[model samples]
Target chain A: MPPTSEPSTSDTAQPTDADALQAEVTRLRELVGPDEAAYTSLKIELWAARDSAFGAEMAAGELRGQVKVLEGQLAQANRNRRWMVERIKAPLRRVKAILR
Target chain B: MARYSILTPVYDPPEDVLRACLESVARQTFQDWEHCLVDDASTQPHVARVLEEYAAKDRRFKVKRRAANGGIIAASQDALELATGEFVCLLDHDDLLTKDALFEVDLIASTDPSLDYCYSDEDYLSPDGKFINPFHKPDWSPERFRSQMYTGHFSVARRDLVIEVGGFRTGYEGSQDYDLVLRVTEKARSVRHVAKILYHWRMMPESVAQNAEAKPWAYEAGRRAVQDHCDRTGRRATVVDGVVPGVYRVQREIEGEPLVSVVIPTRGSSARVWGVERCFIVEAVRSLVERARYTNIEIIVVMDAPAPAGVIEKLERLAGDRLKIVWYDKPFNFSEKVNLGAAHASGELMLVLNDDIEVETPDFIETMIGLIQEGDVAMVGAKLLFADGRLQHAGHLYNHDPFHAYFGYPANHLGESSVLACQRETSGVTAACALVKMSIWNEVGGLTPELAANFNDVDLSLKIRAKGYRILWTPYAVLYHFESMTRIPTVNLDELKVMRERWATPLKNDPYHNPNFEPLRDDWVLRSR
Candidate 1:
């Protein structure tokens, strides 16, 4: 009989210390697979979030432009509604003539 | 043996201004011209003296004094009779021609001998001799000409065409030149526009340039002349005075009540509009059915699959027989939905409308139909207003980029040159409420699906224009657009790149927009760059 736990000429077909270590490493990789996939997905979401923020900033800039235009239009409307000098002076001149 | 003959009808012009006018002609760089000046019995003594002096100095200045004071038309006819050149150029008594005016005209004429008519940009000369308000006119806008005499100054026409059009009519005294231009242009073989300020219009106290109300009869004459042009052109239209004095509106009569297919693409979205939460699609269909004056419209709603069933039922109840619902189970693409709705439509005309739109003008459909019926105009857009009654779109201006003319201006804001009050040709119009012929829509393959959300209408407009069809935008048709209420309109950078690549030339050079205008600006302000 050969030594039971020791390596012999036919020991290559048996599970040795190196083979067991390789099997343990394979099991650990299988355990971390789902978490690695989740991390990659989170990275992709981060990039999308950055893109959305940039889009929001651009939209905000356009809204600012719109606000400026609206303000200008308001000023123009006010000007249009204001009484002209000729119109005001005409009434004043008529009142002065009546007083005279 | 002169190449050009200038006609000037004098009537009590200030001596200094008249002399300056004559001197301006005399100082022309191109000397192959003769000035035919007719004095209509001026009460001022210096008028005759200045006329005689100009005539004596240069034989090109031929002066004639009338026995009695005939009006401007008669004086112009007399001056016309004295013309012995190939082309006759109209000049006012007080207005001065730029030094290179004749040279520019001759240069273009030399290139194109068949050029029957030519006009140029002009500016106003104040009483203090300061040049202000330069009119940088666009290239040969016949629709704009019908709205107003934009090509009033530096008008040059072939002598034979002028004579054939009967020179100037007696009845059109105040607006004789406008009448002549309309008649001449009707039969013109080719028309050219010189994009240079070749005339300085002297603004006297009584001049129409100084005060629009100074000549009230002129507006009436212009209206009549426009109506006459319409009648001659076999268009059943009426000309009416516009909101402004000089501009005229052509109210075209629609022939038959052609069925219009209103294609609206929506997600059955709702927003707090004017402090009321309302479903956009329901209100849009309701307004089309109930509020619009034109009732011969079929509403086709292309609703997304995720849309509420209640909105569909409401639209069905509201629109009754005029309603057609098409389910869109795909991703959101405005262009694709519009195409799908249009595919199911059975109408002569197709109106591409956004669901966030509400009909403001009762005759909005009728107005668009009338405009689309005009010459070669395949597309007509309504004046869209924001919810707060601010202008959203007047017309599209593609100056290196697409911009809405007078965007965010007040609803009543008469744009630079009363553009808002007039119906005219534009580079493009928004699809928010655009009416196009079904044939043209099919020809252009409808809105480009690649564009999806942004610039789809602009792409369609350019395609139609490329096929020699005109696109018109009228303030006559108005609607309120709750813009981007249903969706956030973020510009896709890819779509912009596609637009730049496809419509590079047209985007840079808009025929309706002047080159001197600022690029990327909605207002017609002069470019500082």
Candidate 2:
């Protein structure tokens, strides 16, 4: 019998070949069923976990991409700020001295 | 039949280095070996000359000159064709095998002829001619191997099995050996380990053996190798770049949402830890609720005295729907409290956490749960750190006195002067933060109620291990254990006696721990003979 198949409870305890085989199958099922159920659940959870991990990785990738783009923009702004500060400083000093 | 077919894929190694490697082979104690040296079209003419010389000098040394540079993997496959022996052993062109390396391997194989794979202990040889970083490895640990190829060299495998696993593939030059080891071991009936340091890995400036970062592509190849192993084995898992370079963090996903019974035993005592006044039970529960990303966890608080009146209301409020208070007013036995908690808990996996512990990682429960859910993994443990940022427990080592590995070691320290930082196999993990399969826990009769304070977890782990299951200590699953932080340490001399009497043999000598190492030390320092 298949490991996943449920036991046939309707079978009688008669001394027939099919009955004996079915009874043996039911006995084996009784032994392995609970463990099989737990294993099945564990497998299902594992798939979910993998999917979740993959999703997390994807989200992290997107965030990293965004951070990289932002970092570049920040660097450009810093460069522009430096240029403006240097260029405007002398003129501002000149204006301040005249005003004083 | 020739016992070993030593495959040495000679590339552009220096002349002196090549000579040393050849000399080491000639010095082997076990003589029945066919050394197949494949020259992978080195730019230097000396490389070919050295191989030709070696081949001419000894009939055991066979030469295979490649037409083009096929890299390490393809060259290894070509060398495999020339191999005519029972077993295949990989030896880097610049690396040296110890004198009795082959002898020890042959002895193990002769004893158990059906053993599919065997490896010996190895250490790196400094350029200044010093033997350093000796790796005293444990017996065949599949999980440890998956974490990182601790079994790096002196790998002796059944020749048929090597070819069956496709010898080796191209493009995995930097970590081709790791890839092959993974594949070959997957189908192996028995994998034995020789604990003696028998392989000398020479460290050169250019070799990946020297610095893993030298070939950054190697990490990606390693990741793929581990992934392929998981896929073939039908395990739901993924491998990612770890906190450090070269080491991999293998993340396994348990398929279903198996309910985790977060059983915490506490007396609800308040203590000022690092200038912050906190109740142990409240904070531990709060962290589990707020930090742990997983949803399927029931926080069962086994309290000694109904959480002092108003504290009970507050705890219930904090825990919300996930709290179940099991009152155990009996004279404080740590084991009984835990056993009572397990009885009350309605979950497949039992996660026993110390009341003083706070979750450091968001995925703490998930990581521990994933490990216990895996087949044949009886229990799971986490790396616990103290409040002052020192290691409280990083797994345990049984010796003359059972002690924690890296105990009192700096929390941020990466295993000072040894290889304790990697994920590894151990006899036991502390119940300070441990996860166990409830079924297995019951089968092992839970913790011995007699050991109320200490050694209960150790005894349980040893019993679980006896049932042919592994107890894993994961560095990935980390937590802050202000260990016995807000609780009293009731020294049970009788309980200690019970544990020592029961586990005298294992306590004296841990199979996972090497006898050569000093019994009382934290790191793998050699005990002077």
Best by lDDT: 1
User: Residue B77: error of model 1 in Å?
Assistant: 0.9
TM-scores, all models, native as reference: 0.84, 0.81
What TM-score does chain B of candidate 2 reach? 0.95
Please identify model 1 stretches exceeding 4 Å from their true place. Answer: A1-100, B484-488
The residue pairs in collision within model 1 are none
Q: Put down candidate 1 lDDT per residue, B253-294, tens digits, no spaces.
A: 998999999999999988866545779999998888889989
Scoring only chain A, what TM-score does candidate 1 earn? 0.46
Where does the lowest 10-residue lDDT sum fall in candidate 2 chain B? B412-421
Worst 10 residues of 1 chain B by lDDT: B520-529
Residue B363 deviation, candidate 2, in Å? 1.2
What TM-score does structure 1 among the candidates reach?
Answer: 0.84
Error of 1 at B454 (Å): 0.9
